[model samples]
Target: MEFMDHLHSHSGLLRLVPRRPFPVTIAPMQWYRLEFHMANELGTLLPSTFNLSDIHVECSLLDKSPAALSSHWHIDWQLLLQQGAWDSEPSLQIQFLIRPINTSLPPHLPAHLMVMVSPTYDGDNSFYMLPLITAPFCLTSKRQTANNLVPNNRAWSNYVTQHMYRGFSLPCFDQRYFLIRESWVHGTPGKLWDSALVISDALARQLLPLNLTRPLKVLDLSAGTGVIGLLLAFIGQHQNNTMLDITLTDVPEALSLIHDNRCLNKITYPRLSVAPLRWGIDKDIQAIQAKGPFDVIIASDVLYEPIKFQDLVKTLDKLTTPSTQTWIGYKRRGLKLEEEQSFFTLCHPRFQILDRSLDENVIHCFGWLGPHAPTLTTSLPPCLPHRVTGVQIFHLSKNSPQS
Candidate 1:
């Protein structure tokens, strides 16, 4: 079977890496490399195991349209997939137009440049896949040296209804999940995750029934970028059978992202709400608990650190009643077997754990079939362990009231 035919996570993604520092001077000639590399679902580069053809590149100024830099720079497409080896350093030679092309950019101010690569696949209804963009680099003058890369914030992850949400195959409604970029620190709660997508898929297919007696109440804990809650809201709004009332909560810093995404999607009060929730904090737990004993509570990729496990369990205990259905989607990074087991151990006292990770209903990868997908895709970062990643689904509920 095709890997994508049964996948639940993204196969692989493309990334543009700069060879070195970018404060280049307007000398006789300047060389800067905007190299292309394929990354696994974990964002680590993979050796050229997949062939990527018919791909497009956009090298342009960050603040201006790609066309604005056309006269100023000429770039060629030298993608990593073109080179069939892992050791090959495939660099594209970007020609510099010593002179400024656009009058809008003042010569006194160095222009910023970013490279974006998008792939066009071969299929029945093939469309341009998600584009991977590089962090902006400063185009400086001969005398300039210092650098301040622009803060990478907010990007839209477009999802066609049929492509992402099998249940959400609404012809008119598509989803644009707002992400805080994948360049976040490990366990940072602001970026989109494969586990979250897995959870989303599970909710759409297995958990949420195709009929609603009451607005199915949902609580998303540690809701980074609010993907789960937002997705539930979108689904409920579109599919009458699955109408939902969702509350997305996270730490203070991460809450703004949820709010922005909420505003970005034009999702407002009643259908969805945003709140600042810090796990283990008594006041925070009390404030959120008042809202639920929710019908369903979703938490994905939150079992990250051992130090935070107790707190997360505490929060879950506070919000769930005997009837609440809690779903957790977890992907282990470098944690030991016992370390991961510790989480379930902590929950043993308050909840009943049903590990359906091995079940056929679970979607191991995202519902996008990217280049080469499972067969040729690999996790190639030497610093990191060389193993493919997978998400585990844990269905938890309060133990029998008698106990």
Candidate 2:
């Protein structure tokens, strides 16, 4: 099948566009443009009907504490959000110049601009649309920046709650939880993926049909961004499901992202579990098995590497028992159908494919209203949104019952 060639899912997700060849220096009282754009996720760039008036734009210090921010200098810029200016079509991006206003040069130095939806605005409460600050930059002053302090990862706060999820027919947890992600520049594990969104929403919807009277155990394999297991954990809490035994696994390199995301969501032990897992590692599989037999196992976009097909299948065969319901969400970007079938071909008698479906329109409404409104726009690599397919879901279970 024809698939879209996109760098990453930025659609519906707001981003502070990185300036090409990042500026070497930022001077105070000089106008530097900060362009905030929502990257495209699905094949389509969703429009933003978000009221312009509700959004706020300003500059912020890179390493200053939230408490310290209130006492220090303040910088204000054009908010760009106007009544008829942008609300007519509702753009996905806004840019304004930010310059220090106060008399202080800031011994710590002001380094980034913040684009946030005002706390007072009662607009769509989706986490994907939460505010974003630009990546840290250099200040003109000779003084050290960030006071030589920079956190490993930048945190974006999205205070959406479980109540917001009740209404969507096909909703994935938006900024509903205070979830955070590392940029691809940092590592791919932390960035959100469209497949994760589509699959999690699909699985969550399927769980609702069970009425969830009993305990539920879940596994999110290759749980980048921790979106899948995290969402289920929230759902489990809402359902009052016992134990809240949700575990997320990925490579060691990827574990920190999952850990950070899980923490930012305020989910803790007994409620959420994160472990380092490599698909073919026997030790990892056995360690994870001790926590099993899961009621449902879920994964997204793990089939991208054709060479690793056997390893992933092997891991699935060992982790799942006859009753374990497995869901795998795959995006066929630039992959041949045969390449995908090859993965299922490896499962053989060890597992059975129960059902398969596609989320053709998982979120067609969530378009990116950026430089190319009604079209794809991102600071990431190029792709065509029209050719993107809804993620493909694979439901599986052990072929025979186990003792």
Candidate 3:
């Protein structure tokens, strides 16, 4: 039984890491491919016993086309069973398991085990036996390959529909910080933002406080997924135990999505509202100001184009009050590092940079400016940890004249 289990485990790992021929062609383009290797040994043996067996696996690109193409590859497993047969001929079983890492169930099969035998098997070779097995398993795929395996979108879609997206529900967060909404296009799945995570961390770190006695008004500019505002509302509920007024502002195309997300999340207060505001446009700024005197403003992943920096600054200048705290989170992208520095350089005099932190690919922060703050150098705090790639946090705050 132990040997059989070992064989099954070995085959399962091998199934996950199949090699491909180099320089596989996709249409006219050729791509390099790679494979992920699995570790040895099934469950640990009791003492010093050692078990060894030769395992061989092969994979080939099958089809890649609109209907079906030959660029995508399917993995085929062939293992030589050498162990002495007790009562039955050796067989191979493949298991398809779906497990999510973030405490959320993955969208497919919990566990599917299929037993197969060589065509030469004398008994029951005509039918395949599939048994459902429910257990936790790691989910990963090949990291790299020598052959460019054009993904089979059709098959992949079928696999996801049949296996991945059906059984799982949207993950729930304690603070109600995420805003998950479907795309405006029909049949598209919904999206979520982790605003609550950001805001809670910032507040705990003394970057900002929840001032409930005074009405907390939040402005989510370029609100891609309305994550920032959603987080603010979640935090406000905890600190003030009251509803937060949040304005979701974005371009015309995103407004409908924002509204849909707001409704889907069922955010009940400080009165969730949506407004169309294009960055750098006066009409848009005026329209956003109609809500007026925002206490906190948030933006996430909004700095991509360099041309939009000045307009963003202009919009910020119009929407923020002298004492307001504005938080902007952005993922670093092409030219983003230099462009962000340039943005801070221009806005440092008018706003005080309060705090900043980098996690994964995102930059999180809080900033404030006095009614008439002086020009300040863009120097981040020394305590911020340096990232593995040597990227340091860039934080600038309005300095008091004496300092």
Worst 10 residues of 2 by lDDT: 159-168
lDDT of each residue in 90-188, candidate 1, tens digit only: 433333333354556635445544433434434312222334444344456545432222335622221100011101121123322222233243246
**Per-residue accuracy of model 2 over 270-349 as CA lDDT, tens digit each:** 55788999999999999999988898888887888889998998899889988898888777554567887898889866
- What lDDT score goes with residue 151 in model 1? 32
Worst 10 residues of 3 by lDDT: 162-171
Q: Give me the runs in candidate 3 sitting further than 4 Å from their true place.
A: 1-211, 234-240, 336-338, 358-403
Between 1 and 3, whose lDDT is larger?
1
lDDT of 3 by residue, 107-147 (tens): 33222221111111112212111111111111223333223
Model 2, residue 171: distance off in Å is 10
| Whole-model lDDT values for every prediction | 0.55, 0.53, 0.40
lDDT, residue 173, model 2: 33
Ranking by lDDT: 1, 2, 3
Q: By TM-score, how accurate is candidate 3?
A: 0.45
Kindly indicate the candidate among 1 and 2 with the higher lDDT: 1
TM of each candidate vs. truth:
0.60, 0.58, 0.45
